[model samples]
Target: MNSGAKDRPSTSFSGVIRQNFATKISLCLLMALTIVVGANYGWRRGLLVVVGGLLGVALYYSSFGFTSAWRLLVFERRGAGVQAQLVMLAIAVTLFFPLLAVGEVFGQSLQGFVNPVSVTVALGAFLFGIGMQLAGGCASGTLFSVGGGDSRTLLTLFSFITGATVVTFHLPWWKTLPNLGAISLVDQFGWIVALALSLCVFTALFVLVGKFSTRETRSLVDDGPVDWLRSPWPLLWGAVALALLNATVLVLSGRPWGITGAFSKWGGHALHAVGIDLSSYPYWAEYDFGRSLLGDVPTTTSLGIILGAVASAGLLGKFNPTLRISKRGAITAIVGGLMMGYGGRLAFGCNIGALFGGIASGSLHGWLWLVCGFVGSIFGVFLRKQLGDGPYRNTQPQVEAAKP
Candidate 1:
C-alpha cells in the first residue's frame, strides 16, 4: 500500500520463492540459528575467533576425508583407508594448536572441549556404528535419508529414537566414562611442537600410502572417481557432507553433534512431565553416564528432519507407502534401537558425537570406536544376511529405493 512498495517490482520478492542453492544456503543459516538458540557451548572458547575459524575449516576437511575412509577400510583401494583420514586429521589438529595459543591472547584462557579416551566411550560408539551399518544409515544419514524419502531409514529412525529412550530409562545404570575435567589438546603438549610433529608424521604417511597404494575399482562411495556434484550422487557424498556439517556443528555449537542423547532426553523428559513417572529414571541414575540418556535435544530439529524428508520425497515425486522387512525385522529394529539408545547413553555420543566427532577432534577414542565398530560390522553384516533381507519392504523401488 505504500509508495515505496509501488516503486519496486514484486519480482524481487517473488524471486526469493524460487528454489535453488540460495534456499539451501538459507536453510543452513536457519540451522545455524538453531545453534544460537539451543547450544550450550557458549563463546567461552570463542575468544580466539580467527584461529577458531581456521581450526573449524581444518575440522571440516578432516571429517570430509572421513567420508571415504570407511569404504576404503572395508574395501582396500590405494591405501585410502586411514591415510586420508589421518592426513586430514593431522592437518586439522595441527592447525587447531594456533587457535589454542591465540585463544589465550586475550589473557582469558578458554577451556578446550574434548573428551578423553575411555573403553566405555569407545565400545558404545562402536555399537552405534554397527547400528548404522546394520540399519543402512547413520544418525545424520537417517535424518537426511528419512527426509529424502527412505522408508527403511524412517523405520530405522523410529527404532533409533525408541532405543535411545529405552537407554534413558536406565541411564543411571549405564554411565562409565570419567568426565575428566574438560581437557584441551594444546594443554597436554606444546601447541607448536604438537602441530609440527603431527604434520610431519601424517604427511609422511600420506606419501607412503599413495606410493605403495593399489588403486582399486570404485566402491559405492564416489571417491573412486566420478563427478557426483551435478546430479544427486550416491550416499557417499551425503556421508561426507554430514561429516563436514558435524565439524561446523562443533565450531558453532561447542559440543559435538549427537542425536541419541537428544532423543533420549526428550523421551525421558516427556515421560517425567506426563505424570507418568517411570521408576527407571531414578534407578538408572546410578550408572556412570545414566543422566539425560533419554530426553535432551530439541524435537523441532527431528521433526524438521522427518517432515523435510517427506516433503523432499513428495516434491521429487518419490514418496510412497511401504514398510520395512517383516515382523522379525521390526522386532530387530526395536531391540537394536534399544541397544543403540542405551549404548549411546552409556557413551557420551552415538555415531555423530563420538565416532565422527571424536575423529574430527583428533581424539584417540574415535579410532577405537571405528575399529570396534568394524568388528561389530562383521556381526551386523552377518545378521543382515541371516535376516535374509527381512524388512526393507519397498513400495516403489524404481522410484525411491536407497542403497543399503
Candidate 2:
C-alpha cells in the first residue's frame, strides 16, 4: 500500500501546533458543556450527547452519509458505501432485536419507531428523498454539514425547519389516509425470528449491490501513523460506530436516535415568537409536547452533532465557510429543505429516524422508507441535473480509498 499523507506535515510546525491546541481546547470545552447540561437533564441524556458528538466525529471523518451513498449508487453504480450501510444494519439488528423484545432496558420501557404503513409514509419518504438530494444532504447530513461550515447547508436547515413547522398545521388531514397500523417483526414472531429476517434482507442487498456495481471496490481507509485521529476513517468502521452508538441511545433514552423532530419544534417556536399560534394544531397542541420543544433529548443530540462536526472539521483543517452560492443553487436548497421538512413529518421520520432507527428496531416501516426514499432519490438526481449551477455537483472532495 502507498504511504498515507497523514504521516507528512501539511503546514509549518507553528501552524500545526496552533491547530492542535485549538482542537484540544475546543474539545475540552464542548465535553465540559455536554457534561454540565447532561447532568442537569440526567446522566443518561448527558451520555447521549457525548455519544452524539462522537457520531459527529465519525460521520465527518468518514464522509459516511446516506445522501451521497445513494446518489453514487444510482448515478455511478458504486456500491461500497451502500454495502457498508447494510453492514451497519446487520450489526444494529443483532444488538437491538433481543433488547427490544424484552421490552425494557435499565428499567425503562424500550420501544421502536414502528409507524403505520400507509400512502403518506410512501409519499413522504419519496419527497424526503428528493429533498435530500436537492438540499445536498439528509437530516443528519444537514446538521453535520452545517457544523462543518458548508454555508449552503445552513439554508437547507432553515428551510427544513420552516417546512416541517408548516406541515404540522396540516397533519390532521393527512392522518385520515388509509394505513396498515404499526407492525413490528419482534411482536409478530419473536426477536430471534426478526433478527434472522433482517439478516436475510441485509445479505440479499449486499450480494445484489456487489453483483451489479461497476466501480472498483476498495477499503474505506488507508493505514498510517496518526491516521486514526486526523485522517478520514474507514466507511465500514463509521457504519459500525454509528450503529452501536444509536443502539446506546435506545438504551439510555428508551428510544432510538431521531432527527427532524427537533427541527419542527424549533420552527414551531419561531412561528410562535411572531404571534402564530401553532398550539391550535393537533401536533403542538398535544399535552406538553410544545413546551418540550425548548430542550429535550433529540434537541440535545442534534446540537451535539453540530458541535462534534465543527471540532472534527477543524482538526482536519477543513472548516471553511463561504456566502457565495449560485442563484439556482440557493433556490434548490430552499425547495429541497421545505420538501424534506414536510415529508419527514408525514413519513414520521427522516433518514435517521425512519430508516436507521426503524430497521434497527425491526419495524417494517423502516424497510418501506428505505425503498421509497431510494426511489425518490432517483428522481432527485434527475432534477438536480436540470437545476443550473447545482452546489453539490462535484463539490465533494475526493478522498483516497485503499485496496481492499
Could you say which candidate leads in TM-score? 2
Model 2: per-residue Cα lDDT over 128-238, one tens digit each:
999998887999989888877777889999999999888988888999999999999999989998889889989999999988788844454445543767777878879
lDDT score for candidate 2 against the true structure:
0.81
Off by over 4 Å in 1: 1-72, 75-113, 169-185, 196-230, 233-244, 278-325, 390-404
Give me the displacement of residue 124 in model 1, in angstroms.
1.5
Reference-based TM-score, model 2: 0.90
Candidate 1 backbone clash number: 26
Error at 70, model 1, angstroms: 3.4
Which regions in candidate 2 have their CA more than 4 angstroms from the true location? 1-29, 217-226, 287-294, 391-404
Candidate 1 C-alpha lDDT tens digits along 283-338: 43443343432122233334444444433333333333345456656655555565
